[model samples]
Target: MDYLELAKTVGILTGISGGLALLMSIAQNTIGNYGEKEITINGEKKLIMDGGDTLLAGLIDNEVFLPSACGGKGTCGYCKCKVLSGGGQLLATETGLVTPEEAAEGIRLSCQLKVKEDIQIEIPQEYLDLKQWETVAYRIDDVTPTIKRVFLRLPEGEEINFKPGQYVQILAPEYQGNDEEVYRAYSIASSPSKKDEIELLIGYIPEGIATTYVHQHLKEGDTLNIIGPFGHFFYQDTDKPMIFVGSGTGIAPNLSILRYMQENDIQRPGIFLSAGRKIEDLPMKEEIDAIAADLPNIKMIWSVTGADPGTWDGPTEWVTDGLKKLVDDAKDSEAYLCGSPVTIEQIVDVLTEKGMTEDEIFYDKFQ
Candidate 1:
């Protein structure tokens, strides 16, 4: 085997391998590609999109953002949509989120459903109008030891029109020790009257990506991205007396609603019940007190579950206990609740037991 002969053989083998690689790439592009497909939404709007991404991602790419607290990880059931056709079989994640009745009615989690072909799905009209906004962190106020109120200012000529109790998804950029960008939903803590500014009452979770960024890395003048006006936990436009229950930063949305009511002079009798582990856990106490003072029809109650009754000035029972004391008949009232899933579940059971119908009790479960 001479050197030239060996060189020629090696070159020939390299050329053959390169040719096969090119062919494989071409095959993948041709075979794996699902190409373009149509997504018919609510039988009114149709979108032409490439058919490969998950339904949630595809909707977002088409400017239709569905509420998913866990992004597209299929953990939060907030992105459930009715798929009349072409959603294929339900996966375990979808089944976990959807009840048997819901599954029978064609409900599926958008995050778990892939758009492999033309599909028809139904989403709320409000979700169709959801928008992603660019804002700057104009202010950060320490509300408590672990909670900070961040004020994001919209750019000129831009505004967010959101219901008082709705929330927005904050996009946390990559920072030290966190290598990827992520989105986390936080309820809008500011009143709807403040169209150009959005406030978020973010509680610091020691190692949480989004909370950590907001607490430690995020600063004034830093640009942030958010998409929202999500969730159906807002106040209904009815004359029924209202009950608002929350804990920790869960009070953010309730505070927004109270402030909005105060701004608009909606004086239906109401009670805002807030619970925390300790005095320090309850943020926005002064603001809540001021709102309650201004609105004669509204009352505020504070409860500390983990504190000793001898030390706490307010109710020492759970928030639900305060709720029971304030409301005599839940059949005539509407309730808006926000908190951890367990807390929301417990309160929902209590409300239902107290004669509040399922439709009258709206809640946002924090994941």
Candidate 2:
């Protein structure tokens, strides 16, 4: 090569080295600065965290995990905490999660509130009960064409104790195609009597991260990580006549409560109203029917919105339409409702028209 060409090549090499050094410096300034100011939480002092992260994350990183089902997505509304002082103004994303009274009380969704400034926050004592537990999948079976029942056994001699109707967050394992694990909450189907095994009735949402894992990727003997028996969607242990309404996998928790009542010989007149698009969607009917038959005061009603070609002889319209003629005197009844958001709202309206007070109806609005 000519001397002129060699000089040009040397100049290009020198420039490339300088450019790489500059890029490294910028990265160190941006990504490497995970250390920021010290923040106090509920009077306890903690180390300086990397600036720009949400307060919830910093708490989790410091081993004070918050009760967040949406993983900082700000959708579940379970991560709310009281920012006693120093926290900034609430972000727009947190508006839907907080009520006017709560806002006045200094309540904020920890996941939405960034810890740019050192701040103190208060969390519920019950929230401190939340913990991560590693479990093993003892069994996975297709309960229905659309629903699968997964039973996770806590390690031998281990216990996962929680109240009936509470839900647990199952961590979807990371696979080659997926980069991170995601949590999906499912109501515990197992009775509170069984403390070691956690059961879930999962409805398959096609190609959904957690559902797909439960439906296709998971298997017997595989280990799965899960967290908490959170949520308050169970039976209230009242003597009033009860109305149970569920559709799809929403039926899981209701069934557990019903079985518990039966085993304990708790006699209270009750009606279970289940709705489905087609006959196939109504799986576990025989078991539910048996429970109803064995319990003198328990009644079961099945309604199908979209009829099957040749088999259905039940109500032909929406499930709430069936409630019109059934719950004539809803004033004396306690209603438990679980289903999709739109369906639950419509059913609530019908229940209200039937004289059921808003306070008497307990519902878990699936988001």
Which candidate leads in TM-score?
2
Candidate 2 off by > 4 Å: 1-24, 27-51, 61-65
Cα distance off (Å), candidate 2, residue 197: 0.5
For every candidate, C-alpha RMSD to the true structure in Å = 3.5, 3.2
Tens-place lDDT digits, model 1, residues 1-367 = 9999999999999999999999999998987479988999999899988887888888877888888788678888988999999989989877777999999999999988878999999988888888888899999999889999999998898989999899999989999899988788999989998999999999999888899999999998999999988877897999998988988899999889898888888899878888888887889898789888888987888888888557887787888777666677788789999998888888888888889999998888887
Best by lDDT: 1
List of clashing residue pairs for candidate 2:
34-50, 36-49
* TM of each candidate vs. truth: 0.86, 0.87
Error of 2 at 354 (Å): 2.0
> Model 1 Cα displacement at 310 (Å)?
6.9
Please list the C-alpha lDDT of all candidates, in the order they appear: 0.88, 0.80
